[model samples]
Target chain A: MSWNVGVWIASLLTLAIYSFLYKDNPFYKVAENIFVGVSAGYWAVVLWFDFTWPNLFEPLINRGNVISLIPIIVGLMMFAPLIPKISWLVRIPLTFTMGVAMALVVTQRIQGEIFPQLQATFLPLAGVSPGVLISNLLIIIGVIATLIYFYFSKEHKGVLGFGAKLGIWFMMIAFGASFGYTVMARISLLIGRVYFLLHNWLGII
Target chain B: MKQTLPLFIVFGCGFFMIIAFFIPLGGFQDVSQTFENWYTGVIAFFVFVGILNLVRVNTERIQKRTRDWQYSIILLIFLGIMMVAGFFIGGREGRLFLYLFDNFYIPLGATMFSLLAFFVASAAFRAFRARTPEATLLLIAAVIVMIGRVPVGYWIWHGFPSLVEWVMNVPNTAAKRGILFGADLGLISMALRVLLGIERSYMGGGKE
Candidate 1:
C-alpha cells in the first residue's frame, strides 16, 4: 500500500510535468522552481558531507590533524566573498582553482585524446576482412578530406574543396548517428522508470 | 575581492597541481584531496547562483507586470511551496525533493533536449539542398547515418552496420577530439592568465 501510494503520487507528478509539451504553463514553472530550490539545498548538504565537512571539520575534531590544514585554509579563502571587509582573500582560492582546472583540462586533452586519436589513424588491415579493410580506408580518407575542408589559407577550388565538402557530409552523418544513440539511451532509461513505477511501485504488472 | 584575486588563486592552484604531478610534495595528498572536495562546493555555489538568477528574473518580471508575469508568479510559488514541504513536512525522510527532481526537472530537461530534435530535423529538411559537393555529401552521409543507425540500414545493405561504427569510432572521434583539445588548451591559457592576474576580464575589470 505504501509503495503503491508513492508510485501513484510520482506518476501524477510525472504526468503534470509531461504536460509541458503543449506550452510553458504554471505547472511546469512551479515544478521547475521546486526542482531548482531542492537541488540547491541538497547540493549544499552534499558539498558539506563530501568536501568541506569531511576534510576541514572532520580532521580538526576527530583526528586533530592540524598540519593538514593549509589547504583547508586556502579553500576557506573562497568564503572571503562573504566578508565584505576582506573579500580580496577570495582571489587566492579562485585564481588557483581556475588555473589548475585549466591546466588539467589541457594536459589531459593532449595525453588522453590527442595521442589516442593519432593512433587511430594507423589501421592494421593485413589480416582484416575485405569489408573491414574498406571501412578503415574510408575512415582515413574521411579524416584527410575533413582536414582539407578547413584549410582556408588558399581557395578550396579543385581537389581540396571537393575533399573538404566530403568531410562536411561525413561530419554531419557522424553527428546524426551520435544524436540517435543518445536519444535511444535516454528513452530507454525513461522507459525503465515508467516500468518500475507501473509494476514495482504500484503493482500494476 | 576583485577578479584579479581569482587569477592569483587559479595560478597558485595550477602551480601546486603541476608540482604534485612530478614530485609528491610533503603534503601533496592533502592538497590534492582539497581539489577533489572543490567539485561539490563549486557545484553547490553554482546552484545558489542559479536560484538567485531565477528569483531575480522572475521578481523583476512580476514587478514590471510583464506579459508572462503570471507564469513567473506560479514559478515563485512552486519554488516556495517545495522548500516549505521539504523543510517542514518531508525532511530527508521523504522523497519530496527527489520526486520533484526526477519527475519534473528530468523530464523538463529532456524535453529541452528533444526540442533540438525538431529544430535539427527542420534545419536538415529545409537547409540540406544538393547545391555543392559538400552539401551533397552531407545529404548522403546524413541519409547513410540515418539508415545506419536504424534497423532499416541493416536490411538494405550489409556494409552499413560497420560503416556506422567506423564513422563514429574514427573520423568522428578525431574531429570532435580536435575541437575539444583546442578548447582545453584555451581554458588552460585562460586559467594561467587568471592565476597570473594577466586577464582581468572575469572581474568586470575595475581599478585593480
Candidate 2:
C-alpha cells in the first residue's frame, strides 16, 4: 500500500466519524465538533467573499454607495441575538428574509413548480404507447385520489373513503420507493468512502 | 411600536416584491433588483450569526466544564485554525485552507452521512413490517424496488428493472404531485398570513 499524508489524514477523519456507528466516543465527538467548526468557518468565508464583499462592502467602499449601508446595518443587526437587551433587533433581518422569500416563492412557485407539474399531469393517452397510456391513467387516478386523501373538509365515509384508501396505497408505494432510493443514495456515499479508504489509503485495489 | 414596525416592514417588502415581479418596468425593476441584492447581503450575515451561536454554545459548555468539555476545546481550536487560514491566507483556494478542507472536512462530511447506511438498515427492518394491508403493500413495494434497482434483480429477471421503473414513474410521480399541490397551496396561504402580519409567531416572543 502507498499513500500520501493527505489521504492518511482524510482516512483517519473518515474512520473517526464512522466510529459513531459503533458507539459514541471521544474520537467521534472530536470529529463531529471539528466538522461543525470547519463547516461554519467555510460558510463564513463563502459569505464574506461571495455576498458581503461583492454586494455590500465593495460597493460602499468603491462607489460611495450609501444604499448598501442599509443591508449592512440590518445584516449586523442579525447578530443582535448575541446581546440580550437589543436581541429583538434581529427581527429586522429575519423579517426581511422571510418576507422576500415568501414574495419570491409565491410569485414563482405557480409558474416554476405547480403549473409545470399540473401541465405534465395532462398526458396524451391516445398518442402514447400502451405502457405510457397505462402509466398516464395511473398517474391521473393516483393524483386525484391522493388529493382526495389530503382533503379533510369532508367526513370521508363512502366514495371519498374509497378514494382516500386507494390514495393511501399509492402514497405508501411512493414512500416505499422513496425510502428505497434514499437507501441507494446513502450506500453510494458509503461506497465512495470505502473506495477512498481501499484504493487511496490502503492501495488494495 | 416594536411589533408593529416589524410587521409593516414585512408587509411592505413582501408586497413590493410581489408587485415588482409582475411590473417589470425599468426603474421599479432596478429598485427590486437592489432590494434583492440587499436581501442576499443580509442573508449572508446569517452565517456569522450561526457561527456566533455555535461559539457561544460551545464556549458556555467549556466554561461550565460540561460533559466532553475537552472536545469543545478541540472544536474551538479547529474553528480558530480554519477561520485564520480562511481570513488571513484566503478561503478554500489557499494552501492551508485547501489542505484542511480536503483532508478533514470533505471526508468527515461524507463519512458522517454515509453512517446513515447502517441506520437505514435498522429503520428498514422496523418499517417493513406487514401489519396492515397498507403496510403489506408498502413492504412489498419497498422490497421490489430495492431488489429491482440492483444487478442481482436484473440477473434474476430482466423484467424487474422495467417493473421498478414503471412503479417509480407512474404511481410515485402521481402521489408526489398530489402532495406537492396540496402542500404548496398550504404554503401560499401561510405565506399570505405571514405577509399580512397574521403569523407573528416568527417574531420570537409570540406577542402579536
Candidate 3:
C-alpha cells in the first residue's frame, strides 16, 4: 500500500532476512552480504567524520595543535601490518591502546563495581521488617555461597562443598531469569518487525 | 627493541593512568585526558583497517571465482554506494544516506535480531527439560519470569508481578553480585599482569 521506495526496500530486505528461517537461499545470502557491507561502510563513515576527522584532524589542521599529530602518526602506524617489512611497528600502537584500556578497566572496576557492590552486600540485619530481614539474609548468604562456588583454588569438601552447592542453585535461578528476559526482548523485536510489515508495508492492520 | 619497547610503553601508559586517578593535580588529569583522546583517535583508524581487510578478502574471493562470489559483487556495490553517499554527498545528513540507514539498514538489522527469537524458542524446547533438581529449579524460575513479564500474568494472578520483583531484586542480585565481584577481581589481576608484562599472550607468539 505504501508508495515510498524506502519503505519498500526495507520491507524487501526484512523479508529477505526472514527467508533464512525456511532455508539458506540466494535471497538470504544477498541480504546477509549487504548487511555486512553496509555495516562496514556505515562504521567507516561514522569513525571518519564523527571521530577521526573532528578529534584528530580538525584539531591539528584548524586549531594548530601540534600535539594531535602524535595520535595521527600512531594511528597511521596501524596500517604497518599491510607492509610486511615494517609490520613490527603495529605492536607500538596496539600496546599503547591496550595499556590505556586495561588501566581504565582496573580503575573503573574497583571504583565502580567492586566498592558499590560490596557496600550494598553488607546490609544491616538488625532493625528491619520480617520480609526485609529475610531478603537481606538471603542476599548475604547467596552472595557468599556463589563466591565459594567460583573458588576453584579450594577443594570442594565439608562446608565449602555445601556452600558451593547452594551457590549453584542461586546461579541457576539467576541464569533462568536472564534467559527469560532475553527471549522476551527478542520476541518484542519480532513483534515490532511484524507490525512494520503489516501496518507500514501491507496496510492490513 | 620491539618486545621490550611495547612492554615499557604498556607499563608507562598504564601506570600513568593509575597514578593519575589518585593525583588529580599538577596537570596529571590533563595528561590522562589527552591519553584517553589519543586512544580514541588511534582506535578510530582500526575501523578503516577492518573495512580494508573486508575489501581485500572479498576481492580475493572474486578473483579466485570462489563459490558465492557473485554475492561479493553486490556487497561491494552496496558498500561503495553507502560510502559515496556518506562521504562525497552531503555527508551523514544527506537524504540518500539517511534513507538507506532508516529503511535498508534498520529493517535488516532488526529482522536479523528478531529471527533469533524463533531459534531461541526452538532451542528452549529441547534444552529446557527438567532432568535434575537444578534443571527443574531453573525451568520453574524461567517459566515464572516469562509469565510474570507479560500482561496475561496479571489476569491470572495479581501477586505474580510482586513475586517476580522480589525474586529479581533479592536472589538475582545476590548471584549477579557474587559473579561481578569474582569477575572484577579477575579483571584487575589480569590487567595488572598485562601492565607488568607477565601476560605476553596479547602480544602474540613470536621471538623477542
Candidate 4:
C-alpha cells in the first residue's frame, strides 16, 4: 500500500479517538478497542518468538539441551490450571518462578531506585553559595516533614506534627511541578506524531 | 469477591519486592529473576482477561442499543481485525502489523499521553489562585523553580537559575525522600496485613 493510503487510514483512526474528548462515542471506542487488540496481539507474538520459541524450542530441539527442557516443562505446568483436577499443580511452577523473579528484581531495584536517591540527600551546605545552603537545608527539612505526613499508627505531636504538615505542603508542590513536567513530555510526543502526519506521511509540509 | 483480595496481593508483591533487596541471602538473585519473569507472564494473562471483560460488558451494552452502542460495534470490528492479524501473521510475516503499528498505534498513544498537557495547564491555573497562605507560598516556590529550570528565565533574572538549583537540590530532594520513606513504611504495613490474611486482594475475592 502507498504511504498516502496508510496515512489516510492512520489520520482517520486518530481523529476518531480525538473525537472522544467531546464525549464518549462509537468512533473513539473503535479506536480504543483496536489499540488494545493490536497491542495484546503484538505482545503475545513477541513473547512466543523471543522467549518460548528461541530459548526453549531451539535449545531442546536443535541442541538437545536437557536443562532447557526444565523451564519448558515448568512453564507448561501453567496450563495445569486449565485442568481442574490438576489446578493445584499450576501453583507450584507459578509460585516458584515468580518468587525467584521477584527476589531478583527487588535486589536490583533497591540499588537502582533507592541508593542513588539516598546518596543525593547527603548535600554539602558549605562551600556553596548562600542560596544553595538554604535550599539544601530546606531539602533535608522537607524530606523529614513529608515522611512524617505519611506516618500512621503514631500520633505526631509538637515538632513531629509540624514536620508532617510541612511534608504535605512539600508534596503538593512537588506534585504540581511533576504534573507540569509530565505535560511537556506528553505534548512533545504528540507534536512528533502530528509532524509525521503533516511532513513525513502526508508531505504537506 | 470484593476488591480487597487483589489489594492484599498488590501490597504483598510490593512488600516482598522491596524486602528481597535488603536480605542479600544466597540464591536470592536467581529466585528474584524468576519471580520477575513470572510477574510478566501473570500480567500478560490479565491483559487478556481484561479484554474478555470489556467485550462482555460492551456486547451487553450494544445488544441493548445503549445510548452510544454504535461505538461498541466499531470497537468490536477493529478489535477482531487486529486479533486476527496479530495471531496469524505477527513477525516479519506480519509486515501489515508493523505498518499499522507505525501509522496508527504510535500516533494514538501519543495523543492519549498528550492529554496531560491540557490537564496540567488547567491545574496550574487553579493552583495560582492562591486561596490560602500555603497556596501563595507554593505559587511563589513554583514560579521560582520554573524560571530556574529554563535558560531564558535565568537569563532575565540571572539569580533565578541558581535559586532554582537550590530549590530542587535541597528542598525538592529532601521532600521526595521523605515521601518515599513514608511510602515504604505504608507498603510494609499493608504487606503485613495481607500476609496475616487481613487484606486479601488477590484471591479473586473471597476477599479473605
Error of 3 at A73 (Å): 1.2
Residue-wise C-alpha lDDT for candidate 1, range B1-208, written one tens digit per residue:
4654465466667677766766666688666656655533443444444566677898999999988677677667666655555556565345765665555555545544544454566666888798876566556655666677667789999898787777677656645544454455566677666556677654442244
The candidate maximizing lDDT is: 3
Which candidate number maximizes TM-score? 3
Candidate 2 C-alpha lDDT tens digits along B63-176? 999988888888888889989998899665899999988988899898988899999989888778898998887887788888898899999999999989988998999999
User: Alpha carbon lDDT of residue A6, candidate 3?
Assistant: 82
Q: How close is chain B to the truth by TM-score, in each candidate?
A: 0.82, 0.94, 0.95, 0.74
> What digit string (tens of lDDT, one per residue) describes model 1 on residues A68-170?
4655666666666666777676555555556666656655666776677768777877799997787677667766766666666888878877876676766
Give the per-residue lDDT digits (tens) of candidate 3, residues A9-74: 889999999999999999999999999888888888888888888878999999999989988988
For residue B23, model 1's alpha carbon misses the true position, in angstroms, by 2.7
CA shift at B171, candidate 4, in angstroms?
A: 2.9
Would you list the rank order by TM-score, best first? 3, 2, 4, 1
Mind giving the per-residue lDDT tens digits that candidate 4 earns over B60-93?
Answer: 9899988777766766665666566666766535
Q: Tell me the TM-score of each prediction against the true structure.
A: 0.73, 0.96, 0.97, 0.73
Candidate 2 scores an iRMS of 1.3
How good is the docking of model 1, as DockQ?
A: 0.29
Task: Tell me which of candidates 1 and 2 scores higher on DockQ.
Answer: 2
Best by DockQ: 3
- Assess each model's interface with DockQ, reporting 2 decimals per model: 0.29, 0.76, 0.81, 0.31
